[model samples]
Target: MEIIFLDQNKWIELAQVHSGRIKGGPIAQLFPRLVAAVREGRVLFPLSVANIMETAKRNDDVSRRLIAETQAMLSLGYVHRSRAARIEVELRAAIQRRFGIEPERMPTHWAIAPGFMQAFEPMDELMASPGELARVRRMTSLVDPAALYLNYMVTQDDTRRREANAKLSEGLSALVAQIEGRRARFASESLDMRRRIYAAQSWVDHLDVLNRIVAALGYSFDDLSALGDSTMRALLEDVPTMNVEVEMATRLEAKTGTLSANDVLDMQSFYTAIPYSDRVIAEKAAISHAQQAKLDSKYGVILSRSLEDLSGHYVS
Candidate 1:
């Protein structure tokens, strides 16, 4: 759609009227007539036209009077609410792209420059000067006359608008590249951590096997410090098949009222094997620690390790 740029002086006039200095019936009566001229396409300048109409609507005394004047000026033809609405939609999308969020959704008042940035690329220097551009970026609400005037000013300069558009395009591209890089890094780290977790799991399973052997033997490990290192290695090697033999020996010993060599082996295995619960708790703590490390790396803040510590306590 073709857009007519408004003159800067017209904007200044609208701004003055908005400031409430132009008082009384004559100015109020002239307001509606001026609006009708633009609405009828007799006068053109998109920004000025919108501003004049908006200003009139805001002034209660002027607005009611203009309604009568506007009705008398023409047949009241179809108002271009849809066109205005479309502009508003485009403006909002542009603002979102520039700010990385929807302008209307922001906590602060919005302005036209940010909306323009979303709509067009900004000049490199202008883009770099966030403080200056911020004045324009926060034009979310149309209620502010300053925001409306800024929008009018931006529309008047094709060169500035083009520069702004280019800057925004460059900024968005850079932002996307940065996000993708971070995502790739995270995925790589996650896979590596998964491998470590599996290795830890294997260690735990081995520990559980040793515990089962010890339980079957029904031997106390309290006095195992006397056993030689070679004897301990032999007990560890026999953990897999020791359960049934250990149980049988325990029964035989109960019947005969005497402990055997096989039962002693079982007791040794039990002492060396890690408990399944202990393994699980350790694995969980490791995962929790890894997660906190990742978060700290990403956000530059250390998260509480309390949850991981708590999980370990429960599992152990």
Candidate 2:
């Protein structure tokens, strides 16, 4: 099935429409068709952890309720499948081999929400289980350490304005708080270190994802190293997060860009979407960045700003 990665803004738009806050709006009219596409299995809207947390931050009950309703309608979009524990270890190792990431650093398992293992029955059965629901809730997060590190390096060389940098600082703060909380839990009387382990290991999985992208493009590390930075970025590698950063650098050098934290976060989300998603609906700026990076030509990801536009393009 074609995976549809909806941007947070589109979700909010849908929620606003579905909640009747934006009555008779053109965007609102598109919701039913989008839902039909999902229900028919013509497309899948997988809510990224980022998508969930952003939705959760809504202040109004109407919006939150709409989010819940939308999630339920899109339940079949959850794509994670459980493999044998031994197979998982082998997969991680194989991914490490292709990516050149150290085996020690690779996560032994995909990061799971608390008690996800206990809920690992068949997908259909697990979907109704409290454990599965909890796992989905736990997976909601916004921290992207790999992207943050690259942003830090890029900011150092570009013009770093405190106003423009504040968002980046806030994101970093959130990431730190998450890690500290995990550390505290792991150090306490509780011996359950799964959360701590998963948190650290997930980043390695992110790297492995980049490796797969590079391999699919038929580029070796040496080939990537020698390519123009602009060319290398088209692959959407997050640890290096070269695509958006390169754009940021160009804009900064040309005195045309003000790097905001939201831009960085959006870029991270877009990058994360490409590997698993067949299409990505995101903010116009993020889509433009990806287009400039040649994402469409390289990875065949359909990047669009409107859910309606994407639906019409793919579902007709």
Highest TM-score, which number? 2
- Per-residue accuracy of model 2 over 1-316 as CA lDDT, tens digit each: 5677777777777767777778875676677777787667676665554554454444455555576466545533242223222223333444444455565463322322222122233322223367755544444333232222223223333233344345546775675465445445544432224422442454354566545545665665575556555533323333322333333323222222344445445644664455446778888767776676576666677788876675344344
List the candidates' TM-scores in order.
0.18, 0.50
- Tell me the whole-model lDDT of each prediction, alpha carbons only: 0.32, 0.49
User: In candidate 1, what are the lDDT values of residues 33-136, reduced to their tens digit?
Assistant: 54555456453222222222332333244443333233222212211122222233333343233324434453211211222222222311123358645644
Clashing pairs in 2: none
Candidate 1 TM-score over all chains jointly: 0.18
